[model samples]
Target: MALLNQTQVTPASFILNGIPGLEDMHIWISIPFCSMYVVAVAGNCGLLYLICFEDSLHRSMYYFLAMLSLTDLVMCTSTIPKTLCIFWFQLKEISFKECLVQLFFIHTFTAMESGVLMLMALDRYVAICYPLRYATILTNPVIVKAGLATFLRAVFLIIPLVFLTKRLPYCRGNIIHHTYCDQLSVAKLSCGNIKANIIYGLIAAFLIGGFDILCIAISYTMILRAVINLSSADARQKAFSTCTAHISAIVFSYSPAFFCFFFNRFGSHVIPPSCHIIVANLYLLLPPTMNPIVYGVKTKQIRDCVLRILSGIKNTKSHSV
Candidate 1:
């Protein structure tokens, strides 16, 4: 459908440009991407299994960690397979409906991850600042409700993006200059006025990312104050140590995300398109790939449980042989 007549016609499919200048290197590139995807899937799955089946791992902190792992799993899964197909098989075309579906999952899970991080911060805050009430404050029922609320908030904020993108008439060419379909990326393909799309995208990002960051900051601030006042050096060290993994997770998850978000909108003139695409992919891939390793190394309980599980398996195998 041509835009020559000023009559709007939606393209049935959009062509994803896989790493604009690095097309020749895509096969080589997929090596690391595929590796990361495999690690992310396996590590997150292990975390979920441990948290679900190990009775000792069922605290509020681990519950929030499970949610973060689940979110990372889905977020990476939703994009990487198709991305690999695009890179290795030259499968660049995604149906319009499929694009919208991908956009929904990508954005929704991104928001949900932020929410989960905020919840984790809150968990640490209560655990450190109000240790006496930690159990009562973050009971299983409360955790479930918090999880539900986080999910609902993400859904409520992201559904409009689907509609907004769907309503845009794709009179422009159907080629998206990236691996996967994102709201702003897809919106850029439309010849229609996209002020609303841009505005709403910024607002949603601000509300989800900004609000969550603020809450996490406040939680940590209070946690720091409480830790400082603790008389015992050991107690203070323990409290800060418990939060290290969560803090690392937050930094790994948000830093790339915010960089890509602002860079795409403002840094295009200064940054290469390839760099943007690479960062965008990393924004989804890095956190999932790193979170498990970070937590497994930082948290003694998780590390000990994993060691026990591995030893039990080893013993079973030796006996069977």
Candidate 2:
């Protein structure tokens, strides 16, 4: 339909602004993003290999961890390559279809991450609040089903946005600032009335994104109550400690996202362009980078697995020596 619309009316070419202090920024952005891309990929890939290869890690928590890693990797891949192109190579021109595809994957993976976090919360809730049923309640099949549901639902939910984007006429601006197909940024460029798209986007934000956070909060509420009632100091510490990583992940994932909403909706237009660039990259990059750190810090098993994997490689090379 967007293609049909394009045929009907000639869309104007959008003029793009090179980053201020372009020559200096060219090298500066390159160094950090290059390093971040390496870490994001390496950390996520290492987690993926550990989860896939290790037999002991084949449980509900690791299942969710693997999913989180995969989602974060996708999230990083979608934006970082194009971002590098823009910053280092000055490759800023992206076709309309390419832009929409980027938007879909970015949102799809993010929504799936939200769903996975919700599932993780449920897993914790069941384990802590209903200990007797933990094993049966979170069976292998059940975990797979939860992950599948999260992935499919996220992908399908974004279908409407694709159609909505197809309907809108984009004659105004082709150049998307801040390095990626930010939904709001794209919507702002639409030539036709985008009140419907904006409202729908907000509804999804609050209902799907915001609602997941609420569910997580409620689950933790029950988990905390259960933990407090436990008689053993060791038991309470154990339960609370188990949740620390998940709690940190939840806060980091949701805060910047919702804060972006606040800034976009209420903040002044006078807000610096750097604010947009910084916040956008932070939200995209932080989740994947911090995900490994959270699990590594909070979960001893993952940390051990990471060390074992590294040591095994070292031993292989030592033998070669």
Candidate 3:
């Protein structure tokens, strides 16, 4: 038994069970997943292009938005393509090292996303509450520093996860019961004690989710107070309208994520595994897909830019005809 344990410690690879009871539907499932992946990629890339090129979008708000879009792009890309491969080609094998790599990207980008959202909230808070000093507050250097801080926070926080997972002895058979490599799911496969993994994972999740959510809430609260005090009705309306996209983004990003997290940790026994897995995929895919749409619809600047580009293309086609 001891020799068997020693030999099995290093698994050549782990087989990903795409979705436990939905094996037959994997092909069908890939269709929508593929469609969302395409939309997320195109939309985020469009935002990035517009932000980089459009002189009008060179504001602190758009700068933060560009960061958010970039984060969304990387977060979804890290998981969705491999998920599609698992669903479509039946290519579900992932090496231990590759799994850890995926785990790092997924978690790191998630933390980064949360950080970006917090920054967006802060931007709005400052813009609304301290209109006079908004320019001075979020200067180019400050925005750059904030972005760098978020990136570093994500990197430092997630690098340990890789090491913690690496040190584990995977004596159990290498079958991950999900589409992609989830930290908890992979940690659970280890024969060695995983209390450290669980504790650290919970801590990391709280540090990212709890801290960000709290800050966002506080920022919005102050923004709300400031808006209410404005003398003109139009001013109040404008203030609230500016936040519509950010609020939608917050809902799209955090709601499913927190649900999936708690469900995976606490309600796994009661909830269906397939449901949990589906929500987990959504937690990754939905935000990237919806965020761009939300911003495009609600943000006048981005919407106008998109419209201008479309008009240009239309005119070019008409001239060609």
Candidate 4:
């Protein structure tokens, strides 16, 4: 039987999942993924432009949206291009070091994105529950501090993960089932006893994923309570409507991750690999695409600003003609 030493397993096992196929994969998957990548980038770029150019959008809500767009962009940038190269361009087998870099950035940005979403939920709760306090609570300094702290926390927490993976030996088969270096998949590749890694990964997931989701739920609960006390039905409806898109995005993002972690633990490995990749892509891509559209519809100022920006561009074109 083959044996693994301390240096046998490359860090790349944690970054690139495996070079399973250079040819046999369906073209259909690659094409749609490319389309989604384009849409995600374009949508996020448009949101950034709208926020930067439109002075009226300088408010706390829109500022938070801008940060959300940035996080979504990071999320897409981290996963999509590499995935495309693997699936479409036939560029498989990333270097061990490159894989670790990818793993770090992917987890960091994703955790940060989750943290930002939780903060946004809190922002909404503050806005709806204590309208007067919204400015005080969601000030630039406060938002900046929260963002910085969240980022630092994600970076610091995941630092240990890199070191842990680096120490694992890879004597057994180096094949990872998924496209990317997911925790469980990577752990399965380790030749050493991986009970510790498994426990750590599950704990990290519970702490980061479970904790963030819990915070979001609590924020929404408080918001709901405040909404209930509102005398006007219109007020309650309007408040809830503003949160609908965010709620949808959160549910979409969290549910699949939950399913992947929980269901796969039991005997239900029925979910195919392709489905997992698609859902992961959706979580990163869909939010940026939907946010501007939803917020534009929900907020009158944003709607008018987008329309005016469109009109101005058209007028400029007409004048040039």
- Return the clash pairs for model 1, or none: none
Q: Give per-residue CA lDDT, model 4, range 175-272, as digits (tens).
A: 55556665556666777887777777777777777788899989999999999998899988988887886786677567656656664576346756
User: What is the full ranking by lDDT, best candidate first?
Assistant: 1, 3, 2, 4
Q: Write the per-residue lDDT of candidate 1 for residues 1-321, one digit (tens) a residue.
A: 346443446677899998999999999999999999999999999999999999999899999999999999999999999999998889999998999999999999999999999999999999999899999999999999999999999999999988999999887798899999988889888888999998998999899999999999999999999999999999899889999999999999999998898897899899998998889999999999999999999999999999999999999999999
- TM-score of each prediction: 0.97, 0.91, 0.97, 0.89
Against the reference, the lDDT scores of all candidates come to 0.93, 0.80, 0.93, 0.72
RMSD to the true structure for each prediction, in A, is 1.7, 2.9, 1.4, 3.0
Q: After superposition, how far is residue 225 of candidate 4 from its true place, in Å?
A: 1.5
- The local lDDT score (0 to 100) that residue 241 gets in candidate 1 is 98
lDDT of 3 by residue, 205-304 (tens): 8888899999999999999999999999998999899999999999999999888888978998899999999999999999999998999999999999
Model 1 TM-score on a 0 to 1 scale: 0.97
Best by lDDT: 1
Worst 10 residues of 1 by lDDT: 1-10
